[model samples]
Target: MRSYLTRLLIVIQFVIIIFGLLQNENRAFLKQLFLRSDAVLFNGSLYRLYLHQQKPRDSMLVASHAVDDYSWLGAEPFLVIAHGLGPKLYGGDNTIKTLVKGRERGFRVYEVDISLTADNVLVCYHGGDETEINAMRYADYLAVCRSKGQDPCRFDDIVSYARKNPAVSFVLDVKNRFYDAYGMIRNAVGDQNLGKSFIPQVYDFEQLPFIRKDGLFAGEIFTSYRSALTNRQIFDYSKKYDVKVITLTLQRFVEQKGDFPRDLVILTHPVNDPFIAADVKKLGARGIYTSYITHRSIPELFTSALFFTPLKQV
Candidate 1:
């Protein structure tokens, strides 16, 4: 009877474990367990995307090295982590909690993906290529995302947080279009004279004059160029506008033998290679964006025995 009872208890516990895994309320918590790269999304019950890290690193090994992860780059050549504390580093992306944690870890500048809802409310989300999202109301979007185990960051919340934490700065990456972008932006700005604290990224050059008309959004505008021809045009037009930053996709940045365009703050994304990081440094990059900025050091950006080798921070 004792043996049978013990066996039954073990089976019961096993069943309970499996049941919990299936009905898990903490999907975000579960993501930290199997995440290979930065973040993996589980849409309620259907989707399971394993975002295999571009170069897989052991989470435990990375976590163990955090304290001594010799930070090489200070303010200049400023490091901006796209979408807040990289999903891999913080177990999620762009959440108010994750961003606050990043600031605690000494990260100052953050790039957040922004979109305007059907109700004219600006919300924070990286809904690129998700065409259906264009039609959803703010509440509807939030509900669907939440029901799908996603936490949507509110633009108002992020703005307020920035106001409270003056030391921290934000780079708003416009993910989708808005009807009255100026009003939405000004409303987000609220009372914070976020002079240098805020930088608005624009894709269309025509939007610049309108955005600048407010005067409150008087910070340097960040724009990108597709072709070399477009690059030259933007450069020429920049002489008339206050476009002070140029962002290039990491793929394009890597294609260049030398560095990005000089004189402006050139920031590239998802750059994980030390060789590339070093080359960009030599090319006079204003900054490099990496998901592992907190988990690893930029090569040659830190003091190490192998002068050029960046020591991993995990």
Candidate 2:
């Protein structure tokens, strides 16, 4: 019986060793796969993706075009100021003034309209029914706002306001289900120049356009908690479309770690804590979208001017 017990113990040890080896091999395989993917190649590098292929003069032309046409040149890091709700719900004027101030300080401001009224007007609000808004025209919404003692301005008026103010760039957050809203915005901003100035972000996947790289609205693909696609899938989609920026949650950023494409711009919630911000910077985030930029007058927090200082060298 003692001899049998010893044999059983030996078998158990052998099984444990096999399991350990398998685990190690699995981890190594995953590491190799990640390396093969080349997802993290552009981290901490200052290389342009399309620069090598294009000519020196042509590259400058493209850079200038992106800056002038695509809203790239104004600042190192872009500041996307989302005005939540209307003037009645939140202080709308205060939000606008703060954004204007940010733009004056050379930060590009993208204001999102989130209200879902039937008229589908873009006056700057958060999370409303897209279907309802598109059903109602912007003209009707203006009348409704005036009746309610609110400022009445058409979506075109907002674009005009941005045009008058050279520093400010508008990110029109279309929170409606109307298929033609994208084309409507393009037509409204007659000049291709003005159309290019606007970045239209869509929350619904069905609403997303197949070819959005050209024209007025750059798509800001919103990934919520209930999103079906994984971080890698989102990154791949963005790369395929040459999408310059993507906005997602802080939790998703942590989970994905180095999986995100280096060329894509990431906009996440502001990390208030300096340590957290430092870590986020190391992870290679382009910008942090927050109301903190409005509340905090200090420019450094909003701007990407500060370099990440290493606590310990890699």
Candidate 3:
């Protein structure tokens, strides 16, 4: 472990020096880099470095079986969630255009934020000041988005799209309002559709009781981004509730120590850096929630952890 840490630190320092030198050489280039997404500015570039330094196998895997429409692996070539629709142009805006762009990139699972409007309607949003968001009706919010040319979408809009495309799935991040937002989604999409298309993320272990009682969603993901629980406690609660997936921030996972059962799926968030992604995989994380990483960027990194097997193994 000591030697591993030494090597890791060396690699990180090398990356920083390389980027710093490049930035110093061309200030205009740095400004252009600023225009890219958060993942692109650092993580994506780091991933390019990883590809060069560590020559992972360069091959594509063919699907072994037909897509399971009810499962999360309908079109998932990689075990990644497209954070905020995955489009750099309007990333985290949660609009129809963003979803389209993410789909174009072959992303089958998307993580989107949803909040309630003034009239108790659920809309895809990541707004601060919930009181202010709660003061605007659905129509008022739509008008505001149009005035800003954001092309916003509601929770229902996403559900409608999902019904049309059964291959796609959504991971809902309702922030702090887990129960209220989930109730609204259940009503809008119905329990059957909710089971088929949506995976609700629970923030706190306290929400597990409600999850157990409701039993509407087919699966649930416990995201420890805001939760105060330790990794072991979270893993226990997840196992108790049959929540198969657990997501933690990269820093959080690195800090925590414990063994997660092999059957449980572990994922880390906002991992666009292939070096960090590989490190987390060594630590037992099976997947990631990424803003910019895609199968096209590095297919080799995803070959091992995919949900489906390739028909013809090389």
List TM-scores for all candidates, in order.
0.64, 0.58, 0.67
> What's the residue-level lDDT of 101 in candidate 1?
65
Could you give candidate 3's per-residue lDDT for residues 184-278 as a string of tens digits?
A: 78778775645557777877555655654544554667897665444665677666655677887765566553366777788888887776666
Candidate 3 local Cα displacement, residue 300, angstroms: 2.8
Per-residue CA lDDT of candidate 1, range 44-147, in tens? 11212222212111231111112211122234444645445444355456677677766655566677767777677777676655355466578886786677
TM-score of 1: 0.64
Regions more than 4 Å wrong, model 3: 1-70, 73-78, 90-92, 129-132, 135-140, 143-148, 191-194, 212-214, 257-259, 304-314
lDDT of each: 0.54, 0.50, 0.67
Model 2 gets an lDDT of 0.50
Which of 1 and 2 is ahead in TM-score?
A: 1
Clashing pairs in 2: 114-125, 117-133, 118-132, 118-136, 119-136, 120-133, 130-176, 130-177, 195-216
How are the candidates ranked when ordered by lDDT, highest leading? Answer: 3, 1, 2
Ranking by TM-score: 3, 1, 2
Cα RMSD, each candidate:
17.8, 12.5, 13.6
lDDT accuracy of residue 277 in candidate 1? 60
Q: What is the lDDT of residue 230 in candidate 1?
A: 31
